[model samples]
Target: GAGVSQSPSNKVTEKGKDVELRCDPISGHTALYWYRQSLGQGLEFLIYFQGNSAPDKSGLPSDRFSAERTGGSVSTLTIQRTQQEDSAVYLCASSLGTSGGQETQYFGPGTRLLVL
Candidate 1:
């Protein structure tokens, strides 16, 4: 079985530019999550998708951030106008179930975004 994976291990962009980050969750996993880790800050939940349910976007920092999961497998996080403060490691995780019980989340290596 494959684990969660992310693309473009590193990205460098000018402020105000747009960037798209991709993630592929393990096959058959029904729950997926996106998180961000800024310098000197802990990991923050960004968004989540479970099965065919509407995504939870409450964790998104602002209107500039958005994401979508296609076919309940691959997901993409899009930043409309990148900012210096948006520089961070974007991580993706997947779990077998959505309940907050015994399911364990597997994380990807993360995509590092650097907005200049």
Candidate 2:
């Protein structure tokens, strides 16, 4: 892929139902990240995967929220038992793993999750 891509730009689900969002990262990029943006809020780091290294799961908000990056490329974010507060835009980005945050990240058009 030339750029990061996310599926179903807008999703509306009933409260308590689970949802699975997908992210496809750019080719050759080693670092993939998932973030959440609440209404008018900053991006909250959810999870990070850099190459073959053990995934950095420190940012996951709760056990209900989880993600996995397979083959060091694509990723999926699963929100189990979604709540009203869990509604937000889920964003994915990719960057060179070794560089610090100073490097510009390529971001996908985020998936908007709405829990009704």
Candidate 3:
């Protein structure tokens, strides 16, 4: 919990009601990513976990979204029944998931979901 840490940085519901953003990483990072930034557009790759494999949710954008990463750190992104374009700003990142290339991501301080 030194770099990637997010939780209720700001959240406002109303449309459908359903939110649970939360993330905690940076310790012995294995690889965790969930991004979404609307309003201005840029980063939107929500879902990815690498450790026990099987987690790249293919950038969830429907099905009301969903995410989970237990035992490998801590993560929980649920936005069921919510609408209003799912106002975004939810982001979380971690790295050190060595494989072949690319490995350097440490971000958090997002979770500004406002759907009113």
Best by TM-score: 1
Question: Which consecutive 10 residues in model 2 have the weakest lDDT in total?
Answer: 95-104
lDDT of 3 by residue, 1-116 (tens): 46888998999999988889999989998889999999888998878999778898988989889998999888899998899989879899888788625677889888899898
**Highest lDDT, which number?**
1
Q: Rank the candidates by lDDT, best first.
A: 1, 2, 3
lDDT of 1 by residue, 23-109 (tens): 999998989999999999999999999989999999999999999999989999999889999999999999986575588999999
List the candidates' TM-scores in order: 0.96, 0.94, 0.33
Candidates, ranked, TM-score: 1, 2, 3
Candidate 2 Cα outliers beyond 4 Å, as residue runs: none
Instruction: Please give the RMSD of candidate 1 to the true structure.
Output: 1.0
C-alpha lDDT of residue 105 in model 2? 88
Candidate 3 minimal-lDDT segment of 10 residues: 95-104
Candidate 2 similarity to native, TM-score: 0.94
